[model samples]
Target: MNAPDASDDPTPLALPRVPRLRVACAMQSDTGCVRQHNEDAVGCMIPRDDDPLALAGALAVVADGMGGHAAGEVASHIALRSMLHVYYASAGPPPQALAAALVAANDAICERAGADPACKGMGTTCSVVAIVDDRAYVAHVGDSRIYLLRGTAFRQLTQDDSVVARMVRDGLLTEAEARRHPERHVLVRVLGTKEFRPAVAPRGMPLQHGDLLVLCTDGITDQIDDATLASVVRSHAPVDACTKLVELAREAGGADNATVAICSLQAEPLAAQPDPSIRTTRETRAH
Candidate 1:
């Protein structure tokens, strides 16, 4: 909520001649100091150099679960898995395809919650970013956020769909007060609701070498300010930036589960080949 007015363009100033760019990515998640279980989930799909979707981009998603205990975890897990699966296989453009994926995930989550009584009202906040060629495409619902950092300019790419956020925008509340407000976590538009609609970025944001795209749950933003976040990312690599950001959130009282994913655009030759599914994080822990 501390970012510049959402009215400003999120696309950074592009270089004169953007080259064949590639993404370097990493993710980290934790239960935090006060939480007994991690309800947050993080995932991504970085395609092979030869894959058709490779130019369309690599996808990264972060979801913050909200129903309580296992129900919340289930909602987030379902959202992550469903989105990634639906996204890669769809043939639509990045913006349209990403929007459809979120809608599908919302339906999937709703269906799961209804079938299981314990998960009756379970829901989650989902934020996704796709870096394709030299452009970044995004779609999200709820308060989980996507941020773009280009050079010294750091901007938030998504808006919070919550009561406190509305008040702040309407000039009824200040950012400082909104952060501490009791209803800050009471989001108005989250996954698992029939009315949930993903807000898709109007167009792909132009990118440049050294540009950094970040996706994270509220835990990280709640505890640290934007200046701090920009500094951590600017000083570290993608993997280390995620680790350091999560650690800082934990140190800052760790009120909820913290999760972070980073995608850095580097001007370099394409790699030979690669493969990784989005659900690896959750499934790995099951072992």
Candidate 2:
């Protein structure tokens, strides 16, 4: 809840770029400071910008599923697959597609749970960001989060939809107090609920060179403090940043499944710009 300060960002480091807009992501799930099986799941796709048949760049998500009897894993996978399908099949801005995909995924999870008695009450927290035409549209539910780093500053975009979060919003609990609350783990919204209506609105933002967007589950944020998290991201490569983040979470006694997806949009190469001959595929006007 503290505004990012110099102490927040990890010491700056050198990170190279790939030919196209490089989105280097890495994820690790530890049974964690303690646990029998990992319940977290992550998915990524870098769709072709020109190919009409490609599903790349349409959607990338990180889901932290929760349920008893191994139902968490099932929910995560189902959400990912269904979201990807809807995202690609539908057309429009990345935000609209992302919202549609999330709603569809939520329906799919609900349907599956309805059919299987054992998987009853299964649910998953989904946080997704879709990139199109050098912009990102974010949709999230539950405590999973989306963060951004621009220049030397860091900021978190999505608000958590959890019991503790609701308390904070209502002014009944301070952020620091919520961190230590016994019921902090309680979630308010997640996929698979019969009354599931996720916060699937598309929140579009301009993409800047060297901008970094991170979508992660509660596991990572719950353990590592925001200042430390931002520092690690600023100090290492995307892959290494993710590794370090997981390590930090473990160091802080990771009590849940930890996952992180690092996406950095470097400046497009001069030669990579679209040609005038092809029609521009504008998703939305610049903000």
Model 2, residue 12: displacement in angstroms?
44
- Candidate 1 per-residue lDDT, tens place, 113-169, comes to 999999999999899988777788988888988898899989999999999999999
Root-mean-square deviation of candidate 1: 13.0
lDDT per residue, candidate 2, 7-79, as tens digits? 6677654344333454545555565787676788888777665678354364678888888868888898888
User: In model 1, what is the error at residue 239, expressed in angstroms?
Assistant: 1.5
**Which candidate achieves the best TM-score against the true structure?**
1
Residue 208, model 1, lDDT: 88
The parts of candidate 2 lying over 4 Å away from their true place are 1-22, 53-58, 277-287
| lDDT on C-alpha atoms for all candidate structures | 0.88, 0.80
lDDT over C-alpha atoms for residue 152 of model 2: 82
